[model samples]
Target: MLQLQVPCSWYFWALAFGFNLAMHNLKNILISVVIVSNLGKIIRTCTCLYKQDSTEHHDHIE
Candidate 1:
């Protein structure tokens, strides 16, 4: 009985550890994705603004 109980307890602990690790990794991945998406949007916005500004500046040159 003791040996069987020990293996059961170990299995339960192993499951719990794996679950915790997976949750942590998932959270990190989500956070990184959000940050990357926001950065891309910001870069795109900046480039658009720069192009508009340059075009308007050229129109005024003549």
Candidate 2:
């Protein structure tokens, strides 16, 4: 009969690889979310300014 044992070092390497992958993915997600949120804010601000400018123009004509 032959018995085989798994090495502990293999588990250590696997843990390190998983940790690195998770950190990299998290960083990418955070960056994309921040960019999207900022873009939305910019668009909203522009629209508000345009609306105000248009209202002022209409009042001047009246």
Best by lDDT: 1
Off by over 4 Å in 2: 1-22
Q: What lDDT does each candidate get?
A: 0.96, 0.87
Q: What is the lDDT of residue 25 in candidate 2?
A: 93
Best by TM-score: 1
Report the C-alpha displacement of residue 40, candidate 1, in angstroms.
Answer: 0.8
Worst 10 residues of 1 by lDDT: 20-29
Q: Assess candidate 1 and give its TM-score to the true structure.
A: 0.60
lDDT score at residue 61, model 2, on the 0-100 scale = 100
lDDT of 2 by residue, 1-62 (tens): 12223456667778898898879799888999999999999999999999999999999999
- RMSD from true fold, candidate 2: 6.6
Question: Considering only N, C-alpha and C atoms within 3 Å, which residue pairs clash in candidate 2?
Answer: none
RMSD of 1: 6.4
Clashes per candidate, residues 3 or more apart or on different chains: 0, 0
